[model samples]
Target: MKRIAILGSSGGNLYNLGGKEPLKLLGEIETQASSAGIKIAAIQFIGAKASMDNANESTLSRLYTWNSSEENIVFSEEKALKEVNGEAKKVDSIIAKMIEDGKVQGLVLMSSDPEGVNNLSIKAAAKKDIPIVGTGGTSMATIQSMGGKVIATSGTTGTTNRTRAVAAIQSLSRHWGLKYKPVISSSGKSSQNLDENIFQRISFRGIMMAAIPGFIAMSIVLALSKIPGLAKLNDAFDLLIKGLPVVVAAIAANQVSGLDEVGIVAGVVAGMLSIDGGLIGGLIGGILAGILAFYLIQLALRWNFPGTTANIVAGGLSGLISGLIVFFLISPIALSLGNGIRYIIELALNYNSIVAGAIAGLLIWPAIIGGVYHAAILPIVLLEMEKTGASFLGAIDMTGLVMVSAGITLANIIYPKQKSESAIAVPGFLINIAFGTFVEASYPFMFSDRLIFIGAILSAALSGVFVGIFNVKGTAYVPSVTAPALSNNALGFTISMIIALVSSFLITLFANKISRNKRNKEA
Candidate 1:
């Protein structure tokens, strides 16, 4: 079992601007690793306080051996100051220990911090030949840009990150055997200190760049897939649309491995699966193909068959074997899984849709927040949409979200202090709540105050009930509230939206009072 390492956060304000904290980031990474059956060996991080104390200490930083419990991790500036007078080498020391330990196969530097403890990782890679794979940290970014051959990916979503961890495992495992892969990095705000560099931010813009291809694919596919006039080209567009996830995932895996050749071969395998099973299957197949390709290459490398021609022969043969594996084994499984999930969706719809709506409404927040929703759940909804020309889950998901959000925003406007503090709330409440189904706009209120979130659950769930009761259905599969408006029973959807809004408003009034009372008492 190859164990992966989780390095802690970036030191300063860049940390604040970046998405999740290092602790949370590590936990997510661990989850991703676990889901794939990969074992994580260690998680270590230097706390922000250590840098503030103008000293680093072994005691102040935290490390977990095999388990990540609260008891195992510790961070304190005072602890550093108390234990060490000046800068301490605990991070470096731990890196050294990880290298010395035979079981700790690789490191995933999770820090967004550009400086501090990661310097040790870089030095260890350069001199002692340590195997480190970074996902989001600035340290890895910096080295990769400087012409260092580091194996890393800037994975923003959980599914993508899971693929990234697979890449890390493969690269690290290969590295331990030969230590030949060069130290690579990407430039981003994932550093220990607050440093504003234009290039770093620009390099992290790959996600934005990747989105262009997806949007183009979606636009062409959407225009081509649904229209009977374009039926002649429907298969071609469906191929492009469904195959996009495999292509995207393959590209990301290649970037992380720096093995474009293998990624290309794996992508072919994944694309074939997409033709059979659609997006979800393609994604799963893409991952398997990518990992298996690398695994094949690693096996080839171990053979060391004595010539420059060996790589070509080995890689070609490996690609053939990998393709066969994907075709014979993965494709059948993927098709079966797709059928099973569709049946599960049917069962969910059959099990009292109001309850389903309530469940979907409640679960959507966490799923979106955690990002697993996009990878797994949303695709299920999308598949249902494609098949039925509508999705009960999608309606349950979006209508409730929009109306309940509108209610919450209206409630916020009624509050003097809350409205005054956030100036933007004064002008754009209606347009944002009604129009924007990104749905995260409502999150600020929830994160700022959970009472609001609790209130929101009630309204959203009620909205779900109304949507189910009305048997609201959509013809055009769209993203949010507009989806229902463009549906077969537009009035039913609209009425349900209004019902949710009213319910949210009335319930939130009481919830707001309870919240304020709790806050006042706490104060």
Candidate 2:
């Protein structure tokens, strides 16, 4: 039978606000699980003595408690608050163990707070590819942020909490192919229709997270290989670079399958086969493998097959099929597309470097915001680096995008309409200049003023012209301050960055002055 775990904050906002009995919630969950043919393998109550008391009172089997109390079993609000961090860690550990041992295939979470314990548990389940249904507080919002499904609710009353929780559980049950009756809210609307798609299920964030380590490793190896004894390491690093597609595929598969072992195995096989197709092929193959393995595993569970036998069948079949399809059908096409894109980019750069750079710089902002950078541009950057040892496009991103963002934030600090906003910009500016990451610091300023947004993009394009004229090229996604040293023309790249910074700063300063004047006039 499919097993699930229910985790909740005891004596917290859920209980404090609604004055609901925890026992009744447990009973309701059990009732739904019984009707859906799912087993409640474990229930964890997190908080203080009230949680321990609830755990003890729970008639349901396999009850666990992460209480703040040590010797005494009395609930203390202060104690629970003090031990919040420890309790959250314990919750994460327990859930991770349950997922690792395959004791639970799904999770039900109810919490009033979005952070602390709830966030940790959601992360653990996400890492393991377990389905989660949540209610109360910001539980649904948090789950949705991680790209999980949610059933919306209108209020935070005890009845609404129970209704949403039951509906979410019923929805999860239906997803798993169990016999489930749709739960309807007081408005007579089926809870299934209330589900919202806040984020894509594919998880581009996870893909980028997985790819970063490989890029960092490649950068480090390339930088160190120049040292006398590290000459041989270049060959090893080259091999590692070639296997980047496999790395990306493995992580993509895990994200897609919530770390299903069978799905992961299939994804690895597909990625290996799609080596010729580059990162693009591996990504596609891994996604296909994960999807195929997930459905096959579900079918096996429905048929009551042994777990080991089911995993073997699903992994073997999915891997073979996905690998074969990628190798014969997809790889050639992917390779051609990748080469064609690279050829076009090279042609553009050759035809008119200034115009090409300006266009790329102008489009980079929208692409980064629109989720196209990781899905499209990043692979091309990696491919370019693999072939040429550096990327011109990478240089443009560092100078035009990264430097320009830093410049705008710096401008805000120098000419602040409000000191509070400038103080906030300090950290963002430092981070951008120091580590060359998280251009989002400039976002608030850009979003607040249309002129600043337009000025930032135009300034970046102007900087890109300088980068193109100087023929600057470097490793992408590195610390901006240090990025210049990695470029083909370090001095020229530095000049390009300076141009971007100064131009954006001047533009932002002008915008800030205008805004300040307008605010004064309004006052």
Q: Residue-wise lDDT of candidate 2 within 1-523, one digit each (tens)?
A: 8887777654444554332455445545655565566766666645434432253432222223423234111222334333554544566667667777787788776663346555555566666777776555455676767765443322233232334344556557667877654221322123222112111446665675567767656666766666689799789778876787787777776556532445567788878988888777887778777666656655654454433445665666776778778889999898788688778888888999889888888888888878887777776776666554567778877887888899999998999768888998899898888887778899999888898899888988887888789877775567787787666677888998999899989999999899889999999
Best by lDDT: 2
lDDT of 2 at 486: 64
Give each model's whole-structure lDDT: 0.50, 0.67
Candidate 1 to truth, TM? 0.49
TM-scores for all candidates: the values are 0.49, 0.63
The residue ranges of model 2 lying beyond 4 angstroms of the native Cα positions read: 1-200, 203-209, 227-229, 369-375, 517-523
lDDT of 1 by residue, 122-153 (tens): 44444444455654544567756544346544
For residue 385, give model 2's deviation from the true position in Å.
Answer: 3.3
**Model 1 stretches with alpha carbons more than 4 Å out:** 1-178, 182-184, 188-265, 295-320, 366-376, 382-390, 413-416, 424-438, 447-451, 472-481, 485-489, 509-523
